[model samples]
Target: MALSLVHFPSEVWNHIFQYLSAADKFSVRASCRYFRKLIDHWSLWKNWTIVLSFKNGPYNSEFWDSLRRRKVSSVVMRNTKTKDWSRLSLALPTLTTVIMDQNSNGNLNFIQDFSHLNRLAIRSSAVLLDLHTQTQLQHLTHLSMCNVLFPNKSNWSFLNLLPFLSSLTSVVCHNTNSFGQRDRMVDTLVSILPKLKHLSLSAKYISPQRDGSIFKPVTSLSSLELIDCLDHSSPEDVGQMISGLKCLRVFFKHSHQGRPEALSASVIYLKTWLSESAQLSNLTVVKGPPVRMYATSIPATITNLTLCVSGLSPRDMAAVAQQVPDLLHLHIDAWPSHLGAHTARIPELFPKLRSLKLRQDHVPEKDFLRLQQLQDLECLEILDRGHWSDLYKKLQTLTRNRLRVVTSSPQRDAFHCPCVSQVY
Candidate 1:
């Protein structure tokens, strides 16, 4: 006597249905009246996001009616063509977020129709903004535009319209080149958007000089990400930026250029900032040498550190152990050939470490097993070029099933670790 799905309680069906896509839910609804009633429940659609693909052709009235009945609040539009958005405004009155991507012939005038919109993201799209409109997105708190383009008109730029979005707390703008004066642009943004807390922008757009006035107005800013922006800036300029921001907890820098001279200079500058900046706890340096060159300068305050370099030596590990004794989380990406005999020392080097992530091409099973010495370690993530099923099995046994091992290919797998909670 096999149990049928219908015999299960509604709660079990609801739990299973939550994982299904909107299309799958529709199919289930058409299969039976009981499923239809379950799908029609308002709670089922509360967190659902409707995806509108204009490239697939215009949706029928029935589609709009379904969304209206479900009270869809979020929508993602792809390959959007020029269409009358007035219909969307009438159908989804509760719409609060809109994400548009790969749209070249669309206009943002439709945004004016949704007064309740609080989040807007435009990526790889060129859309027209009606700057003359008096309506404002008063509720908008987040705005992200990546590789987006607006009309060349002086008044049509997104920068010109940012002042009107007074409620915005986070802004991410990347690869958009309309910003004329980067220094003044940053200063103006901080001065106007007093509530802005997290700002992520390209370093090329900002001046390297430390403007004292800029930091004075941005007390609310806690997280700042400057991408590919450290090529020209001096260490002193970066140090001043860190020291000025009293509330800054996370500072991330990614540099594509790995000049030995720049990296050496960075070592000195980082030492100075690490000693001075009391609030900075999490530090990540990608595509550069590890901070072991000036290991003595690394403050004990830093608990989470990530170094994405070509190689790390045992001598470097010793230096890190002597300095950042309180380190709890560490992520390292190093060449296997250069990390000679260093894995065996990790447990002794970072005894306080709670989580560790290693990205290497090849690691010996014996060396990998040594990590079990870290009694406090809760999770171990490995990104290797080759798989080691045997090693993983041995490691699980050595730890008495207390440790969680997550392994993936470095080239193809997207590395995700539970220990890394913050979105950098």
Candidate 2:
């Protein structure tokens, strides 16, 4: 009868030290000194991310060796004789999200000492970073990078050394091939962030030299996500080469390796890059099907949306889901002839969906029981990847008739996080 560190409480010892594991949350912060001051909360490492790696291989894809045998506890270094990772103690200044080892070239000088950086994900090697002693990231806003190697005797200009970070908006330039030296990295990041709104340009032919006139400083975009992973140009030649966005909302998933690559990448030449991206609202497409789905619609104050219907068509996604009038979120996957004729055509294809996430195994079982006849579905996630217990017992005889489903699959090192106070 003994378990009273002054009768618990410290939020139940920070919920029993956040149920450990992260190598016992770094050995319970090297055990005691009063549980390392209740596990050093900097939001306990604010949405922390620290992925480590090492490589030199002869393997030929099993998805790049199960992604280099992941299980990164904290600091790791293989083939090591530590030649500078700039003093790693997981370089935590309460880091706000980071991922390393796209074959560790390290040195963005530990992300120029994060000081309330919103998010900055990096992979692959360098894209120039030496902003003459960066001053505490000036509240950086979500930036992602993956510019493999481009140092043919560098002069640095990955957005001209963050000219006054200016609370950047959101930029993601994935695997930017040889990212920089192209409009000095997209015209010095649209002339220095300036409340720039979301932008994601994935592998747009990774600079074998492009001068799309630096997307004419995209005029404070609203949203944009373009992934052209070198399927050899043709989303209307990268939409007339970066069609000067004017408050673009979002448009991407763009990775079509031929087979009608969005109909020779021209849905009316992407509606003239969506009519020069003005007041554009939402579009999240992951390619596959979109050769003609958008000819001249989608811009009635550009309502909200998201798409990836494999390779689109079921009568053009039921005629743009019947002209979206503020559509919330719809993510559908499984487009092999939209099985069994689209389950009696879900109310003529999404008549104003609130939230729907039906994926993978390609929406079957009578179109998932006609998705409980959606009268404005608040939230529905029928995500399947095999063995969904006969569709969770037909969603418990259709709609929460108690399948008593509060199950746990637990198999991450077999245990340590199954608590609702660890069950009955």
Candidate 3:
């Protein structure tokens, strides 16, 4: 007897197709008319990403033509060529989110045609758009650009262009030019965009000095993120800059260089600022060091905390942990040598922690067992790629005990599973 997928009900077919690869799904579509109709369902086409090197591969018009009937809301074009970006987007009228990589020194002409764009991200190269082209993006609420640069190296010219994007509520400027002209980028952004609620900037783009006149209190901002790129600023300088965010709720910063003393000092100053000026609801710091373990205190308003530190000490960890009694989600990344002493202290440090993520550096078995001690923990993830048959077996036992241990391999966004190795 031959096995027949057609014998299955439509719901069963849909469930089965969800587990198949994209190529396998296409194969199923080609097998029968019923399957073809089922595969073209709008649910399957709501989000799609197409990658092509305009410099190498031919334009896939058929791919774009097929999306016309589907409800594609988001699309990503990777390694995109400099030619007509307008024509590529003209085909997708339903697209609300567009992410593209434009070649070096490419004109941002394609973005002008996206009248319905709500979110736009330029992931590669700097973009220089004319005033007329900037006006067309009045509907854009979120914009992310990489390595932003304008002609003549004049910061005022760039600032002048942003007011035209009045509808922008969120802006992310990453890897911006670090010349002295942009010393007041934050103040310029807040002054120009009254509706901006969220902003993210690379720390290197901002100067350490405080511009009291330009950087006054702004109540409109709700969230802020800063990515460190060899920041030379002091903690007091950093604190003063963020102190004006009176309505800010979420503040996340990642100092890639991991200057523990400077970061701790900033946090200490920020804590004082938060108490006096604005209150932050969520705080996440990456590559942080324990400089003020004895002096600094974590704010009580922080319920979600993530601290990625190197060379963490037991006393320092205990001191930092005591600051947040209401924390529900905690993610810690530290050297394995410094982690052992804190194993038994995990439950005591975060009594209310519901989600725990520990990066696999050199974790001991006792630490994992101590993590299992937290009765309130609902999710636990161990991230790394290495031979850990013993650890895997221990986690395997957790699944049987009704405590699912999620483990992921080297991939950044891989899903968690008790048996990740077998599945992968």
Candidate 4:
């Protein structure tokens, strides 16, 4: 009953190899000449996502040079040292997108002549590049920096650097610290980047003061995300900020702490504000521990709602049903233990929901299988941690593909569902 690997065609072998990790592929290549030739096929490695780390010893420049010859387009460098950068740039001049995670002591010399680079991301690192380097990166259209700090010695200001990038359209800065001019940076970004349509930033950086000069409305902005930055004490101030964006269609708010009083007040104030805004369509809350916000009524324009909460109760389910009766898509955090015997009963709460996403670390099989009771659910997304494989197999067998099973990464995956018409 042994299967012959040599009997299969190269196409079939290539398809099988696709699922293997890069190290596994290299190991497989060493097995024989045919396998080595198959691995060397340029079509298999042209669009590679290589993860380089200093922990693995110095990166082999010759191997990277081979990848460059094969035209590898995407790379994710993690925990990279300053010395390896020079070799990386020389190795991959054709790269279009680069993600640097925890890169220590970065400099501009590495990326000075990356003419094809369009998207760049930096996370959890304090890297500094001069204004001259920033100005030369005119081809960059999308830039994302999270939990990153800019060094004071660079004498470079993000507020001033952003204005000159004419090709930039989308920017996301999450928990990013700019020396002393956070207010001015936010105010000037819109005017500087005429092509900017989507923006996400930490709310704390935005000036709470309502200075007309500083807080000008960005009419061209279609999407906005404020992460854990809302003033917990001032619901009215947050409401006022939301009121100015008449063209805003997608809004995402991630609250750090869900103090009952602060959250409830903000929810109540936002209900009134959202009701008046006709253009707003999709609303997603990254985290709300209470799972229930006491809004007077949900906005009629809001057809999509996604919430990531610590826990959920029957009362929370009832509250959402009453508030967002017209909602077509509903996603929430669900814990198996929290649901207990109430799993099947909760599906009836969202009478109009066509799509539902349950996010959890683990799921009791019986509780999850009970979702078959949801008659209106056309799509079901299970966003979970490492324990999802068994549940996925069970759900597939039980649902028989009647419910569209959408899959995504466990980290805030519900928000990235493409089957849902509206997303942020």
What C-alpha lDDT do the candidate models reach, one value each? 0.65, 0.49, 0.60, 0.62
What is the C-alpha lDDT profile of model 4 across 1-424, one tens digit per residue?
Answer: 1248686888998888876766788998888867877776667674566667768676576676557555777777888776666667777777787878876557655566577888887777887768676666677888887878778776776665775677888787777676354364345567788887777666565555545443445566666666553435223333443443433322324442546545655565455546645566676654443545533344556678776554667877777677666778877664433455655655676666788876544446677777776667788775553456666677666767577766654222211212122333
lDDT of 1 at 122: 78
lDDT against true structure, model 4: 0.62
Clashing pairs in 2: 223-249, 252-285, 253-285, 253-286, 289-311
Error of 4 at 96 (Å): 1.4
- Give per-model CA RMSD: 5.4, 17.5, 5.9, 5.3
What is candidate 2's lDDT per residue for 196-264, written digit by digit as tens?
776666534324334443334345555555554333433333333344443332334443435564454
Local error of candidate 3 at residue 320 (angstroms):
2.2
Clashes of each: 0, 5, 0, 0
Q: Which candidate number has the best TM-score?
A: 3
Query: What's model 2's lDDT at 29?
Result: 61
TM-score of each: 0.76, 0.29, 0.78, 0.76
Off by over 4 Å in 2: 1-87, 90-107, 110-155, 159-171, 174-199, 202-224, 227-236, 239-267, 271-305, 308-317, 320-344, 347-369, 372-394, 399-424
- List candidate 1 segments past 4 Å from native: 4-6, 13-52, 59-75, 82-96, 132-134, 182-186, 210-217, 233-235, 244-258, 264-276, 335-341, 384-390, 407-424
Q: Across residues 266-365, which tens digit of lDDT does each residue of candidate 1 receive?
A: 5665566566666666766554445466677666677887765555667767887887788899887664344644787889989988888885345566
88-184 per-residue lDDT for model 3 (tens digits): 6666765677776645555556766666778877665655556565666778898877655655633235555676888888887766552354466
Worst 10 residues of 4 by lDDT: 412-421
